[model samples]
Target: MVLPLELLQQFKASDFSDQQEYEAWRSRNLKVLEAGLLVHPLVPLDKSDNASQRLRQIIRGASEKPIETGKNSESMQVLRSAVMSLACRSPDRSASDFCHWADGFPLNLHLYQMLLETCFDASEDGSIIDEIDEVLELLKKTWVILGINQMLHNLCFTWVFFHRFVTTAQVDIDLLHAADNHMDEVAKDAKSTKDSVYSKILSSTLSSILGWAEKRLLAYHDTFNASNIEYMQSIVSLGVSAARILVEDISNEYRRRRREETDVARSRVDTYIRSSLRTAFAQVSSAELSD
Candidate 1:
């Protein structure tokens, strides 16, 4: 809280291109404070608490008009006092020097995702950094504070890997395969936990993956040719793995049944192959008619 305010004070109007940019930057920091302290705090907030009220009032006013970030400014002092008062309060009323404003559920996930982005090479499109091993080790240090476990890390990494493949023109077969490999770990994590929040996140993440994979697989004849046929196997595997986890692990009805009886991946792949072949045939016939 004070750190952000301090940084704001350290920045001058000259540091930015114009007053508008400075105001925008100041507003973003204020929004971060509001989100961490009031919106999704690690300890559930008490609306009637004096410190919470004061912080909320300050944030609301600052939203309409940016507050002065000067160390000696009256509003800055009030804001700092309110933030510290709220941040210092523990759920059990214990006194502590440490604060946990940024460790809440979705907020923590978002912050961790930002940190994970550093694993990629900024200079080389779609490539991971050579220092990935070191960067990953350092990132692990924040796991305690971010409430991240292996499962969450695997899920986020898979998404990021897959996203890079897409954003960089999808030429990276290794990225696709790496993402598919991560799904194996994700599947294990899915089966081992039944936490409602974790399940919600798992469903959302896997659904995105499955949706993207199926979009390509369901019409593989159109999406892949000899030049990129290597992608088909990995994409199919990722889609099937995601589908199996969603059905057998997450869905209650499917959990009651056995995988041996349904064989989700095999059946799903069979469907994709047949559908793609049919589509390819239909297109050929239509083209002949047009000619």
Candidate 2:
């Protein structure tokens, strides 16, 4: 979900600052934007007519504006408008509708607003390392939580091979970004906390789940050799059922911890997964009939 380098360069060029200062500022903001995207992938523009084009226009408009004061500029307004329109037009209209509606374009806009505030503070005091560190840590936690939920969704809704491919690709991208963006600092801070034990346990559990899912996915792919639709159905049913139980267990754990944000996120993801799985199964059934 990295923004295009050319667009980043164009945006940086519009800032009224020296090369070193602008580069530093751009790098920080880019990390925040990347964090935002990691938590919320962009929706496929094909899901809706012209929405992706509109989003690109809004982004390009931001690049053309004065970067220092562009938070409230006309470009920002248009960008907000585009987000609202896309959200409203999305097929999923639940309270957590935006979660399933598109990528984190709207969420990234919020990150930009946070960046604007940090920029304003930096202009006044010239020191915001503490604030920056705090924001980055929060983003890292959000990214991990969202990544887990997204993997769950993919397991339930997507074809086995496609799901495995995309999830593996995303994990690679996330590791690459973390390596590049000083995420080691965030890891260090987490390691220092008492919650580190719980975090490690959760991490272990998630890794095991993914490993199990990979084996199932591979088996499902092999079922194609015999043209055995029943075998394929059984595999998918087992996978989806296991995913639902796992999701429920995690949701209950979040509830016990009183993590309202995680609860909400999980609920939204659960809704979408159930809906999507139903559609996927229906499609498979329809295809069998057509055969």
Candidate 3:
């Protein structure tokens, strides 16, 4: 199965799970668990409350400091662990992880930065490949301890799980053309209709997908803080704005278009948005090692 049968049963739809069975879910899901090894983008559902818009206003307002941080805050630890965890993977995994993390872009950049440092560290004083493999093993351990399936699921309430993986150096690129292939298929269902927030997300997602190639070229710069940064911010803004329109705001514009029924359009939009975010983030970070 593309996804674990057990995992699919649990995540795809609601089901009965005894405590023990739930615990076992994490273990069986590993190895195949995409450890930030793939890339994609976000397009949150729309609501008439316009809450998404309001939230974006606040998020944008506080972009400089997403949350006020103590010298040592939970965010710091989360970022560090995320970065280190990603770094510890093998080079193939590392590249893919960077692409995966790109889904969140600079929003998750601080953690990404930490991964780059570790990548450099491994490059300098250790058995680069072996060391990374070891870290991946350790992460697997941590995943079990953390009840990774449950934790990650809660953390990612959305249906789409943003984990990417690239194990072999010679893996076929086309074999894993980052999803949204099913975006159209999924969108066609009643759930993804335009009046629905899901539909709005689909539309905006495809819209952003169109811009990723331009951003990939800009990754060569270290800071990329000048033009690239501004450009990315604009892209993120578009995503946020679209998400807001879809999830929180409902209007005649949405009903008038009858656009949600169109999956091909949505799939294209999903691809561009996610690819753009991934490429933009890839440039900002230094090096990343993977298992």
Q: Residue 260 in model 2: shift from native, Å? A: 52
lDDT of each: 0.84, 0.41, 0.34
lDDT of 2 by residue, 1-291 (tens): 133322443463457468767656655554443333333444433544464457655444545653332445554455444454444443443223343333543454345334334412344322224465676445445445344232322222122222232345322222223222332232333234444433443344434544554454543433244533434343343334334333434434644664444444345345545655666687789999999
lDDT score of residue 64 within candidate 1: 75
Q: Candidate 3 versus the native: TM-score?
A: 0.21
- lDDT (tens digit, per residue) of candidate 3 on 147-229: 34322322221112112212232122221222223222332342334334344444444344323323332232332455445
Off by over 4 Å in 2: 1-43, 67-73, 92-144, 147-291
Compare the candidates by TM-score and give the number of the best one.
1
- At residue 272, give the lDDT of candidate 1: 96
lDDT of 2: 0.41
Candidate 1 per-residue lDDT over residues 115-148, each given as its tens digit: 8878987678888888999999999999999899
Task: Give the TM-score comparing model 2 with the true structure, all chains together.
Answer: 0.25
| lDDT leaderboard ranking | 1, 2, 3
TM-score of every model? 0.69, 0.25, 0.21
Among the numbered candidates, top lDDT falls to 1
Clashing pairs in 2: 41-103, 42-103, 43-103
The model with the greater lDDT, 1 or 3, is: 1
